[model samples]
Target: MQYLHAAISETLRLYPPDTKACRVDDIMPDGTEYSPERWLEYGTCRQENPFRFPVFHAGPRMCLGKDMAYVQMKSIAASVIERFEMNVVAKDTCPGICPR
Candidate 1:
């Protein structure tokens, strides 16, 4: 479970799906407006690629597969790293994929 969590954490650290999420619909009794701008700015900082953030599909209807996704990714990554110490053979500055 720890390994799984680690893998998911790493993936999320890199490719966060939503990147940023905001309350599109106001559900508050006070009709408070959710400033998407604020969330975007916060998300940008939180979006420290190669680092983790808190925008893991937050809200009342967030993703339920969050844990599962993390576990699966971790297991696969752990297995690969355990057996091999691989390196990328990129020829250009942009290796196409993020150099994670």
Candidate 2:
């Protein structure tokens, strides 16, 4: 379960929905690398600081459904993984963010 959560976090970090830069120095070590292990410590997922990993926004304006969203994502991901075998057709191709 923790690995699943970490994978999701890594996925989000690699491909954030909104690319709006906040002026903060890159606090993430090896920010460009996709490493789920960074979120794990002693076989558990570590809670990230919202300001550093603001996928759900932060502070007073943080998304109210953040917990529910994680639950839903984990459920869906588990269900899909259990029912199907997925394969990346283009392993050599890397995804790039398009500017709006």
lDDT of 1: 0.48
- Give the number of the best model, judged by TM-score: 2
What C-alpha lDDT do the candidate models reach, one value each?
Answer: 0.48, 0.82
Question: Which digits, one per residue and each the tens of the lDDT, describe model 2 over residues 2-91?
Answer: 888989998987777787766975656555778888888766789899999999999999999988988998999988888987788898
Work out candidate 2's RMSD over C-alphas: 10.6
Q: Give, for candidate 2, the lowest lDDT window spanning 10 residues.
A: 91-100
- The collision pairs in model 1 are none
Candidate no. 2 TM-score: 0.69
Global CA lDDT of candidate 2, please?
A: 0.82
lDDT accuracy of residue 5 in candidate 2: 93
TM-score on alpha carbons, each prediction: 0.37, 0.69
Per-residue lDDT for 1-100 in model 1, tens only?
4323433454554445664545694356756443323213322312223222554555565668866765666678778878987776775564122323
Error of 2 at 100 (Å): 49
